[model samples]
Target chain A: MSTTGTAWTPERRARAALTFICEPGRPDLSRFVAEQGAPDVVEALLASSGTAAWSRRARCLDLDALIARAEALGARLVVPGDDEWPAPLAELDRIEPVGGMCGAPLALWVAGRRRLDEILRPGYGALAIVGARACTRYGQALATDLASRLAGQFPVISGGAYGIDIAAHRGALAAGAPTVAVMAGGLDEWYPKGNTRVFEQILDEWAVVSELPPGMRPTRPGFLARNRLIAALSAGVLVVEAAMRSGAVNTAHWAGALGRIVMAVPGPVTSGMSETPHRLIRDHEAELVAGPADVRALLCAPGEQLEGPWMTPTRPLDGLDPRLLAVREALPGRGSLTVDQLASRARCTSAACDGALVELELLGLVEQDESGRWRLRRPR
Target chain B: MSTTGTAWTPERRARAALTFICEPGRPDLSRFVAEQGAPDVVEALLASSGTAAWSRRARCLDLDALIARAEALGARLVVPGDDEWPAPLAELDRIEPVGGMCGAPLALWVAGRRRLDEILRPGYGALAIVGARACTRYGQALATDLASRLAGQFPVISGGAYGIDIAAHRGALAAGAPTVAVMAGGLDEWYPKGNTRVFEQILDEWAVVSELPPGMRPTRPGFLARNRLIAALSAGVLVVEAAMRSGAVNTAHWAGALGRIVMAVPGPVTSGMSETPHRLIRDHEAELVAGPADVRALLCAPGEQLEGPWMTPTRPLDGLDPRLLAVREALPGRGSLTVDQLASRARCTSAACDGALVELELLGLVEQDESGRWRLRRPR
Candidate 1:
């Protein structure tokens, strides 16, 4: 499938896949579908050889009613290659999926004005805040503070499970940034049911969405499915609270496989909830983040945001080279410029300006990170 | 000058170095101290060249106490290369005590039953469990569980601070294994004071120890000093719970420099308590541990606990080949058979039996984590 855009449509591929997985031995069929691609996934289900595996792919669920329900909720279906699709998730196809960790979304049904891809900026990458269903006050408070502090930077993504997940979504909402919730079951049912009011409120402002088929019920497996999406869609997945054998770790592993940043909050070594994140980090699968600043800096990463030509400084007009002086004077409001752009404006080729930009960067003549497209270095 | 395990007794020398650190244009004293050997470090402090630095070191109350109180506690000041020292802790000597990040101990006033050297068994290593002072339930629980489980196989080390520290010590004690509590302050005031019961108990049953001297109240800097000891004395350091810039991670970095395994217990990504561990693990500076089995399997590192010898039963049976067969036949319940003692009775030469033992090990017939000179391998 050419992934530039337009590959996904309302084909019930998600429902088809769900139907297939719900059957006996069809879980293994995911491998075949992944290798063969989506259309082939349906073909495999239809194949006589695969009939024994799923046996129920032909059973038609009322897909239209489900679509109508989501529509009534004002949700939109986000498929692969769509303009709003999360590009980082492309790693899902390249990163060798381990176990059932492969993340190929049938579609991410969304219900908000916020675009999934836009939130995943170079510096302010999306933060996935997930944890135990039974999080403590320590976990809740920390989650709230982190989400609040990071509100202006990274929007939070989480399951609407109680405890840490709810805390994260609440934290982000409080920060006035949209938080997205990926549900385990159909967005219609609101699996926990208790969080229905919160879900409606969230739907009103941000997004409450899922990959599960419209009528599909939440199961242990569906939770697993939901987790992979949460991890895959973000630039980094941060597990707030996970027990020794938590499902949250499965998400972390998916993020690791996708090469997305996997971060885990550490807890008392005594708590069962702290185990999974510790394991992910200790195994060198994730990065530790202290707060918004660390996450913000890392999200910028190496070579992401450049401040100057980062090659050499342009000499001043005081006995300095004329080319350097020209470029330096052209800076608007003391704004910085890169070598190539500066070269064009200074009436010189990039070769000459590159050398000048480096000196400026080192001399603290410019600042970087907020904009890779350089800026005048402001002193602290 | 020699590491008579009493190097810190030359108190004037340590004072002088502290003085130098407190002087002008000496922000990088840790690097300088690290370059100098223990005796050289002590001497540099005592010489006239260090007078400017000495006055600064002399002003600190804890600095004054380290010389006198460290001795009073029956704590022989242990430094790197001392015969009575732990090999794992050799890394501490490499760090200069600047900004409390990489400094090796000026001296470790150890007071306990287990000598540092004896516990430094090649295979059975050490681990440090550290975390936030105002830790969460999740954080505390994880720290305790990790410590208790690891205690059976390796010594658990910690800062002996509040929250997570208290939990780790209690866990180890509950497991009936002695733990090393590396304190920031002198033994007199257990800083938090709430932990006085356990602190005093440790001095009796285990050991409440530090690099600082007796009566030296824990300064923010001294607490940082205590972190290095926790890092160095262990084969690895496990950060249980910490905010992004929390002190526990400093120990992790120290352990990283020491080339020790750094592990972290993960919590809810939402919880700030988990920030440090997540950061360390995410950055690949620490390993993630899910449970006791995970830590034990990693730290104890059970190698090929499979059954079966590589070769056939025996090729070179010597004279007692048939007798060795008889001994095998005579076995009812599993038991240990001393090399010569079993050989003499079986009428086989000790040399022949020794070869068989090596072969047995290779074949996976028996395994040994307890390295021994003539150790008996339990039957597979």
Candidate 2:
């Protein structure tokens, strides 16, 4: 097999066959593949000389049929040394194992429009947005808003579940940005038939990826194994809302164990859906985030200038009403002004100016003094 | 002037007279009283040798009439050296000044049935519950629950206003515990007449206190000054809910400045009332508390056993349903059991056992395994 170009090598076929034989996040198989190369490990497994578990599983595998099935589904296999493979997945080998799960996939089956390397670049990384499948309206709204605002700068990644995940993907797509959906099942069949519309939309513009080959079904272990890939692929993870012992909390734990920044949006303490987020924030395991700015502040470098949502300076002043703009401009450069004095300078009635001052204060443009005088707050 | 006995000494009369003369939390007068004693400071103010502001206000003071008015209003003055004076007030002299306000009150004009010293003992301390005057129903409910649970072991102190304060005092009174209402105005006249019913109930069983003498109205500065007394008098402060710029945030700042444990309850992000609590928790100014247990966990010292509310071990298991108890008892000692296995062991249907497991999981009595099995969580 050639080292470069579009031709398929023997080693590539062996890696593709291994994805169907062993489950994802198998540390022993991953380590074996790393040390002995894919073709050698595949030959050893075919010999049936490995452990009882591996030998028993290998006896039923057919390598050529799996490769043909992947091709029939229009899925391309990307191995570790492929040009389109993400480099951050290598960090999985260093993290402590969780729930008898560890290590990166030896091969990934990609079946979508966008290239993985182009979307998940080296300097600019993707953000994983995960939450409860049975979410409240508040959680859905916040997830949509955060995803829409962040999509322009970063690729929104999620597990493509029903509530929060579909909302996030729809938000990013609404903003005309590409979003990747990592599926637990094969690309041929979406695990949740209810989310077929969102899955189709994601395949049109971005990618739907999985470690399992075509014709394989999603299992309990498959979903848990997929969470590590979501955490390892993203620069940071933002949990919109989750229950006490849900899958989202499991993903957050993986994010933390991988040394990635973990953030959670706070919700009403009265809701059962907010329990995990509240526990994460209350126990100091995750930073509290309200919007895209808070997410960027935690994910980006200190001096990196964020560009979307409220970060743009021109938008805040331009969005103000005429009366509010007049009131903001009427304040003195150094001293403060009372209601009557501001009314005279702004060329409006005192009541109108007072109402405008309250709006301005909410926008953080002005502040009230102890003597009930109004002054322009210094620019941050 | 006699130094002892039940008879009112001349110095005691001078301290009583000072309560009517100076405003509460007046650093200048507090320092003067501390250095020169109450009688000497009263003499200097009467001779018009003090600052222009004090001399101008002192000229209108009639000490005898003021004392008679307090007596008619059923109020008595308690000074620093009195046995009924709260010792925590002495910490006021050491806290950093806020809003140009500092120092303990020269004397407290108290009216009601309970003794301040006995209610606010040296070992046990009071918890100040303060929030917005215009609060939501959610805030009121949480305030009531926390106060009712905490009132058994600690005195619930608050600024007896219309919303959260009144709710807290009413909760404590409903639990038959002595509560203290620290008023911004004189104890004789409650500031918000809407809360007269609650104020009356508090007076029948607890104490209403203020630094200003009877017949004095509450001013903006007077309200700000009274916040210091609320902070200094409490062992800890719990902010139920507040707007962006409210007095509750100011009280929390004072609590932090006074080295008191500052805590806030989180609410829905959609509501503007949760802004201050969210900001406090986000900025690390206050610990986030959900209910009374979270509050006690922060306020109680290490190894100090908390006795009220959910802290009592006898309450939890006794409150569980029979089905949940049977399911909990069916779990194995070492390994986890599937729902079907638990159902067979507990002699119940699978669906019933499933429901019981969910309820037990919520109560934190049981945990689910990765393979969909149930196990008892180790006791906290």
For every candidate, what is the interface RMSD in angstroms?
3.9, 1.2
What are the runs in model 1 whose C-alpha is more than 4 Å off? A1-103, A106-125, A303-380, B1-380
- B74-174 per-residue lDDT for model 1 (tens digits): 55555545675565554554545435355444445667655655444555566688888899887787778777756656777787778898899888887
Computed on C-alphas against the true complex, the DockQ of each candidate is 0.32, 0.45
DockQ of 1: 0.32
Candidate-wise lDDT, in order: 0.62, 0.82
Tens digits of lDDT, candidate 2, B149-244: 787667889999888888899888877876898999887678898888888887777788898888889988898888888888898999988999
Error of 1 at B224 (Å): 9.9
Compared with the true structure, what per-residue lDDT tens digits does model 2 show for residues A128-190? 999999999999998888887787667889999988888899888887776889989898879
- Give a tens-digit lDDT track for model 1, residues A72-162: 7655666555677676655555566556545466466666555555554444567788888887787788777777666455667888989
Sorted into a CAPRI-style docking class, model 2 comes out as: acceptable
